[model samples]
Target: MGIDLLTIHWIYLIFILLIIVFMICKKDTSLICILGIFVLGVVGTSDFSVAVMGVFNSFVFATEELMGTILIISVITGMSNILLISGINETMIYPFTKIIRTPSLAYWIIGILMMILSWFFWPSPAVALMGAVLLPIALKVGLPRIGVAMAMNLFGHGIALASDLIIQGAPKITADAAGIPVSDVVSASIPLNIVMGVVTTITAFYFLRKDMKNGTLFEEERAVEDIEDKDCIEKNKYKFSKGTRIFFAIVIPLFFAADIVIMYIKKLQGGDATALIGGTACFVLVMISVLTYREKGLEKITSHLIEGFQFGFKIFGAVIPIAAFFYLGDAAFGQIFGEVLPANSQGIVNDIGIALAKAVPINQGVAAITLTTVGAITGLDGSGFSGISLAGSIAKLFSMALGSGIATLTALGQIAAIWVGGGTIVPWAVIPVAAICGIDAFELARRNMKPVLIGLIVTTIVGMFLI
Candidate 1:
C-alpha cells in the first residue's frame, strides 16, 4: 500500500511552479491555470478530447465550490449599497467623527472604526463608508489624506480581512482546502491576527507621527487641490426621515452581531455561518429598499441586486480559474473529471509536499516560512482571497509531514496573503481605499509596505512559538 513517490505526477509540480513564477512576474495566472488543467486532463485521461472538455468542467467545478462565497459577498454588497443610497451608511459612522478632534486621535479612531466596519460589511464597502464620512474630518483635524488612506487600507483590508472573524469568508476557503473544520482555522487565526494587527498598526502610526513631526507628511499637491474645494457631504440628498437612517444604522449592526452570537452558541461554523450572514444581508436589503423607496423600492432593489452580482462575479472571474488548477491537486479532481484517482493516490500538491519533506528535511520553522512565502507570492495577482486555497492545501501537506499545527500554519499563510494582496501592499488592490480618499494607490501601498513587512516577520516568529 506504499505510495510511489518516484511515480508521482510531475505535471502537477510543473504547473504549480509555473504559477508561482507567473505571479512573481506580476502576470495573470488564469490562462496559465487553464493550460495546467488541459495538460493535467490529457495526462489523467490519456485522451486529448477529454482534456479539452476538462477545461470547461474544471471551471464549472471551481464555480460550484465557490458559489456560497460568491453569493454571500454579493448579498452583503447589495445590503451595503442600499444602505449608502438610503444614507444609513453615513449615519452609522457620523457620531464617531465627533471624537476625532486631533491628528493623533484621528489616526486611531479612523483605523479602529474602519476595522470594525470592515469585519461586518467587508473591506471594500467599509472603505467607501468610512472614507466619505471620516476622510474630511481627518483632513480637517490636520491628518493628511495619505494618512487617511493608510489607516483605511491597513486596518480595513489588512487587519480586518486578515482575521475575517465576523463573515468567515476567508477562513471558510482556507479551512475547506485544508480538509479541516472552519472553527480550527478561525480559532488558530485569532492570536496571529492580533499580533499582526497590533504590530502593523502601531508601527504604521509611529512612522506617520515621525513624518508629521519632521514635516515630511505633506500631501501630494495635485491630490490636495482636487479635494480642497470638495467636502464629504452626501451629494444625493434624500427626503427619507432621519428616523429611517437611525433605525437601519442601529439595526444592521445589531442584526449581524446577533448572527455572530447565534453562530457561537449553536456551533454553526462553516457553511452555516456563511448562510446566516448571507441570509441576514438579504433580509436587510429588502427592509432597507422597501422602507426607503416604498413602491419605487421594488425597482431599486433589482438594481442593487444586479450591481452586487456584478461586483461579486468580477472578483470571482479572476479567482475561479486559479482555483481550478489548485482543485486538480486535491480530491476534487476525482469529482471534477469523473474519474476516481488511484486508491493510494496522493494529490499533486500533497505529493510535492511529501517529496519536499523527504528531500529537504523541513522543520516547523522551515515549514512556516515556506507557507508564508508561498502565500505572499500567490498574492502578487492582487486578489488576496484567490490564492488562499493553495496556502491551505500546502499547509495541510506540511502538517501531515510534520505531524502538528495545521491551523497555525494555515493561519500564518492566510495573514500573509491578506495583508500583502488584500489591499495594504498591493497597488492595484489598494484602489478602493486610495480612490475613496483621493490619494495615489501606489503611494498608499508604499506607505504600508514597511509596517506590513515587519508585522509579517513578527507574526511568522510568533507562529513558530505557537506551533
Candidate 2:
C-alpha cells in the first residue's frame, strides 16, 4: 500500500514549516504550536470543541512522555542545590584551582572542569559552582571575563549539555522519539560531540589569544576586591566542619564515578543509566541534607525538592506545548487525537519523509543537512533539550526513508538542537553565562557564533561521512 499524497495532512506540513519560520525569526513557537494542534485537530475531527480538547490532551501526552527527563533533571538539580548550600561544591573545585597558573591554563582548566561538573550536575548549576569559585581567579590571573564565559559556555553548555552523555537526558528524549535505544544515540554522538567540542573550543581559544595579544581583550573593571572579599565571607558562612566538606566532596565524585563504572560494566545504557544517576542524586541530596540540617532536614528537603521542580518545570513549560504539536507527527497522534489514525499511518513527519523520499533525490548528505536544520529550528525556543523529541522523530522519519543510520542522524540532530539552544549561540539561552560573566548576552552569542557554526558545519560534514 502506497502513501497517497492526497490523503496526507498537508496542513501538518504547513504548520511545521511555519514553526521553522517562526524559529528563524527568533520568536517563541509555543502559541504557534498550540495553534497547529488546533488546526490539525479541527482538520481531523471537524469539531471545534473536540479540537480544543485535543489541545489539552496533547499537553498531557507530552508531559507523560517527558516526565522521566523532567524528574531526573529535578532530582539532580536538587542534589546540586544541596551541594551548593552545604559548601561541598566549593570543596569539589578547590583542588582544580591549584592547576590554573596562567591565563591560558585558566581558560582550558576552567572549561574542562566545567565540562566534567556539568556532565554530572548540569551546566546551569555547574556554572554557579565554578563561576563563584573560579571566575575571580580567572579574572585575577588575566583571563578576560568574555574568555571565561566563552570557555564555560562552550564546554559546559555547548559540549557537555549538547552531548549529555552521563545523565543521558538529551539522548533519552531523542532515542524515545526515534524509537531506538539510548545507547545508540550516545554511541553515535561521541564522535560528533568530540568534533564539535574540539573544533569550537580550539578555534575560540585561538581567537581569544589573538584578541588578548592585540590588546582588544581588556578586563572589565568591576569591584574584584569586594567580590573576592564577599565570596570569601560567603564561603566562611557555609563552612561545614572541614571533615564533612571533605567527606562529601570525595564521596560525591566517587558515587558518580562508580555509577559511570557500573554503567559501563553492567551495560546499563539509556534509562538505566539515567535511573542510576537520578537515584544516586536523590540519595546524595537526602544524605547531605540530613547531615547538614539534621533537625530541619525533612523541611529543608521539601524546600529543595520544590526548588528543583520549579527549575525543571520552568524549562519544561515552554517545551511541553511545542512537544505536543510535534508528538502529533508520531504514533502518539492517535492517542492525542482520541481517534484511531489510519492503519499503517506513518504520522506527519514520517509521511513527509516518505513523500520527500519518493519525490526528491535525497542522500546521506541531504538527510544530514535537513535534520540539522530541523533540529536548529526546533532549538530556537531556547531550551536546548526541549526540541530534541522533534529531532528524534524527524531522524526516525529520515532514517526510514533512507534505510540506515538512524542513530547517527538522531545524534546529528541532537547536536544541532543543543548547540544552538543549549545556551551557546542563542542570545536568550546564553543569558546565564553572560549575566554571570557581566558581559552582554548578545555579545557572548556573537563571540560564540563563528566557532559553534564552524563546529556544526565540520561536525555535520563528518557525520555525513559516518552515516
Candidate 3:
C-alpha cells in the first residue's frame, strides 16, 4: 500500500525539525510552535481568518485534553500544601527519621521516600518539605549534603518524575502524542524504569561510598549548619493541635493506601487511577481545612487551591502551546479543521511512519538509539517535558516504520529526557535541590552525569532486546 504525502505533511516535518533545533540550542519554542500552528492552519484552510481561529481552537482542544492532568496535579499539590501548613507533614516524615541509624539506611530511605512523595505532589513541594525534615538527619548520619541532594534529585525528579507511575502525568502527555493508550506506555515503562532506577541508584551509591571512604569528597567541603528555607527550618508554625496533626497524618496515608488498593482491584490506570487519587486528595483537603481553620475553613480552602493551581499553570503554561501544535498530528487535526487532509490519507504521523519505513533502513537498534538521542535533545530546555510530546510523536512514526516497539521507544525517550533535564543533571534544574542542600548546582549535575549516562546506556540496550 503506497501512502501519498501532502504539503501539510512536509510542513509538519519541517516545523518538528525546527522545534528540535530550538530545544537543542536551549531556546524557547512557544513562538516557534505558535508560528508552526498558524502556518499549518494557513496551509490547511487556505484562508487567513479560519487559520487564526484554528490557532485559538487548537489551544482550547489541547487544554481540554490536558484538563484532567492539570486538575489531579493541582489538587494533590493542594493537599500537600495543606499538610505542610497544618504540620501534619512533620508527623508523616518523623517515623522515617527514627530508622536512619546508619549511613546506608539514611541514603536509601531518604531516596525511597523522595520517590514516593514526588509521585504524589511532584518534586518541588516534596524537596522543600522533605529537605527541611530529613536533611538534618541524613547529614547527622554521615551522608554529605551533595550526596543527600543527589538522592533527592535522582529519585524524586529523575526516577519518579520520569515514569510518573501512579500520577500518569508524563505517560499521559507522551501517550497522547504517540497516539497510544496511556496504560500501554505505563506497562511498557515498568521494566525499563526498574532497570534504569536500579542501575542508576546502585551505581550512584557505590561511587558515593567510595568517595566518602576515601575522604576526597570532604576535602574542601564545609559543614552546612542550616538550610536557607527559614519557614521550613527555624519556624514551627502549627495551626492544628498535635493530636489532630497526628490523626490526619495517619489517616492520610491510610486513605492513599486504600486508593492504591482500589486501583488494583478495579484495574484503574491512567485517567481512572488519576481520578481516584484526585478525589481522595480533595476530600482530605476539605476535611483538614474545616478541622484546622474552623470558621475560616471555606476561605482557607479556596486560598490553598489557588496556590496549587498557580503552581500547576506555572509548570504547564509552556506545555499547552507545544501540546496544541502536536495534537494536530493526530485526530484533533480533522476535528479542529473539518477534514483538511486528503482522502485516503491515514493521519499525518501515521502516513509519515509508513512512508519513512519504506524509505529508510530502520531496525530495533537504530530506532532505540534514535529515540534516546531525540528524547535527550528535547529535554535540553530544562523542562524535561517541553519535548516529550515530540518524542512520543517520533516514536509513533518510527513504530510504523519498524512495525513494532512504539512503547519501548517512547519509554526510552521519556527516561532520557527526564533524567537529563528533569532536575537531575541540568545545572539550572538542579538549583532547587542544590539550594536545599547548600551545594553547587553545577557540581551536583556533574556528579549525577556519570551514573545517569551509565543507566541510560544499559537501559537503551535492554530496550533493544525488548523491541
lDDT of 2 by residue, 1-467 (tens): 33333333677778767877887888888888899999888777767998899999999988998888899899999988878878898899999888887789999999999999999888998887777888888887889999999999999999999889888889888887887888999999999999989999999999999999999888553424322322365346555887889888998899999999998899897778889999999999998888777788898888888989999999888788878887888777788765545666667677777777788777999989988888888787788877788788879878877888899999999999999999998899999888777789999999999998899899999999888
Better of 1 and 3 by TM-score: 3
Per-residue error (Å), model 1, residue 419: 0.7
Worst 10 residues of 3 by lDDT: 230-239
Per-prediction TM-score, please?
0.94, 0.94, 0.96
lDDT of 1 by residue, 310-334 (tens): 9899987888998888887777777
- Span of ten consecutive residues with least summed lDDT in model 1: 222-231
Which portions of model 2 miss their true places by more than 4 Å?
1-8, 219-238
Return the clash pairs for model 2, or none: none
Per-residue lDDT value at 398 in model 3: 95
Estimate every model's Cα lDDT from 0 to 1.
Answer: 0.83, 0.85, 0.87
By lDDT, the best candidate is 3
Candidate that beats the other on lDDT, 1 or 3, i.e. the better one = 3
Write the candidate numbers in order of decreasing lDDT. 3, 2, 1
lDDT of 3 by residue, 141-212 (tens): 788888899899989999999999888999999999998899999889999999999999999989998998
Cα deviation in Å at residue 144, candidate 1? 1.0
